[model samples]
Target: MEFLARATGVVGGAVARLRRIGTPARQAIGANPQIPQARPQGIMTLKMPVAQGWTDGRLPICAPGLRVAAFAADLDHPRWIEVLPNGDVLVAESKERPAPPRTLMDRAAQATMRRVKAIGDSANRVTLLRDADGDGVAEIRTVFVQDQNQPFGMALIGDRFFLGNTDGIVAFRYEAGATSLAGQGQGLIGFKPHGHWTRSLIASPDGARLYAGVGSLTNIADQGMEAEEGRAAIWELDIATGKARIFASGLRNAVGMAWEPVRGTLWTVVNERDGLGDETPPDYLTQVRDGGFYGWPYSYWGKVVDDRVAQDPALVARAITPDYALGGHTASLGLCWMPAGTLPGFGDGMVIGQHGSWNRARLSGYKLIFVPFADGAPSGPPRDILTGFLSDDERIAYGRPVGVAIGPDRRSLLMADDVGDVIWRVSGA
Candidate 1:
């Protein structure tokens, strides 16, 4: 099975490259389907299939009560999405590094701090909107605030929106028509940024707990875990109190997180510690318990210790590997459990967006999969429900999914694609 998997990787890459070059190579491959396809296969097209719109084949369904809808589109580097109590979708429509809106919030003396210059780097403006009626779309929307560093996660409690940028977490008020930072900015997290910033987040089912994921401080921290370096970890804090702590530790990077509705368990799709050759470490999705330690700089996936952080024989015994491991280097990202009988083989399974492989020679991921999750836990091997997003052709992708949100209807799945710069709504067949 390992040999066959390797063969799959080899052939998949050749086929992808062959898809790039057009002509006799293509004809030869077309004549011999078993052989790898030719390069530059075809032009990748951007198409968004609306719920009832026409598509090439069977359409994916939302859970019976769920339906997909576009909250917003065409923004700059949008990363996070949060819906408020009054039916407003707040978007972290991020500005680029050295973000220009640094001084926008500096009007007050208290807001003027030297570190604000550091905060100035992420200044991605926030956008807030309302559907007014409970329609599955946004009607009246406007820019809410600015000056955040890679604002990728958000938590909203009474009268405040706690935004998570790479450097720290800041709070804002969610007035329906207000267009600026309404309250005094309070910094809740203090991490010196050396660029390991993929801060995705989720709240406890009850809106009381704000769970923030801080990626390793560096790409591969030279010092390692003692300092909370490159490994991934989750931080839990109270919205009202503004106090926070490291909830769990030693994750290479958990970019996607959600609180399972049924179990009230905090779960995350982790981007395992990388640089292990090509397919050495597997990414994972699992229930995260507070104070529990998962192997990071030390061991991984239950048994394969990284050997980077020299393991104390006793520490290896104590590490917690993932509950379910996706195939190695799959780049698993945004995830949403199947709403209902959305996908046949995967009834109420966990639906994950595999963002595709970047550094690997073989092309994997790029498909939305349904991993059998029963009673709030993983059951079996993941099933591919939304596949073929990347056509047989090479050249370009329509989009790379970043966020997956279940709708108010509770049946449709809403996916935000960063590459295509579009939000996709996939409903049940």
Candidate 2:
């Protein structure tokens, strides 16, 4: 029995790889994608990608004519960043809060993540970095916000600054050139926490409203819709009144969001459900319409119903198709739009931080990609911006990128590598 089990395991691994990785990159992107559902979860033990931190004299690979410099290092799990108006960068050094493993499956999953070093003690602070001499490296580093819950996203509007803590959104008063916030922030609104802790924030062009992207409490609504109340949707809040309402719905894990420069539409990078083999449903980038449903649990990639989910047929019928697919299990967390002239060779487009994969036998993401926009929509295929996060053999990783932001100078791009604990600056060579 033991020998038979071992042989079966090896055969299952090979089959999973063949089913997951054969799709060409071109066929996996754009308005339409080739999504092939593999075996559902639990048939095989989930594969956990190993994390091999950067060795001596190593850096990420950059595109030709582009260079990467270490903007800041020695951070405790830096996951998100914001560029201030004065060209200062705010880095959120945070991790997920520890909760009791409620089920056997959850405990097993936690063990796997701990082995991969995916979970760290919550840093609960935001650090500031400033390149005063116009160089790529930041000479000044200070604690901007500290002693908070696991903070993720940040935004600033005039004198009022907003920070998204795991359970609530907080407001702070700001002064130009100040390194740190003076006191504890006032909580503006509270939401459900624990599941999908990253709450990404962005403000409107006119600064009249603030938007927060809150991910679902569980994958595929496994805990039922009751547990997902006020989750898996973007909330639009009035800056003055502090009132909030859902802007969009059915996005499983919308981690990063930005406004398209030309069309002024809100776009988001979503991490879709897993367990349906590797290539079934592609994680996507889409223009989020108000009150729009992108089909979570019930269906995916428009109207392809997921047999695993019990749903109201009515909900699947209303499911809107995403604009573009970013590949399966990529965990595309960071999204930013680059204005013209920010970098040479790279014209107007969006920069994404793919934090890499963990479900499939083969690894995906773990690099920065640029999707060029022709008239406010993603046009050409995604171009490699900075790679080499994985080892030459692709079995281990040097780091995983989580958040991306264009520097306030409008020339450099800042990437937060959570596992490597370094912030990389990308500029024209």
Best by lDDT: 2
Write one digit per residue (lDDT tens) for candidate 2, span 1-429: 334334443554465566555543433676778777555766543555567677797899999999998899889989999999999999999987656778755665666566556775888999999989987899999999999899999999999889999898999999999999978899999988888889899999999999999999887888889999999899999997888999999899898999997888999999998887566678999999999998987899988888877877988899999999988888999999987788889899889999987666666788999999988898988999999999765657789999999986789899999888999999999
Model 1 lDDT per residue over 1-429, tens place: 334333443544464454434312211011011212212112211111111111343232344433444456565555556656555566676522422222322122112211111122343667775667755566677877665666777776667667877677777665654545664467777654434565776777777888877777433454554566423678888776777788988777777786566786878887765444333456778789888777776667655565555666665677886777675456787766555555333466667877665433344566666676667877666665555445444333444456666654555566655544445566654
The TM-score, computed over Cα atoms with residue i paired to residue i, of candidate 2 is 0.94
Worst 10 residues of 2 by lDDT: 1-10
Clash count per candidate: 31, 0
Measured on C-alpha atoms, candidate 1 has an lDDT of 0.57
Candidate 1's displacement at residue 284, Å, is: 0.4
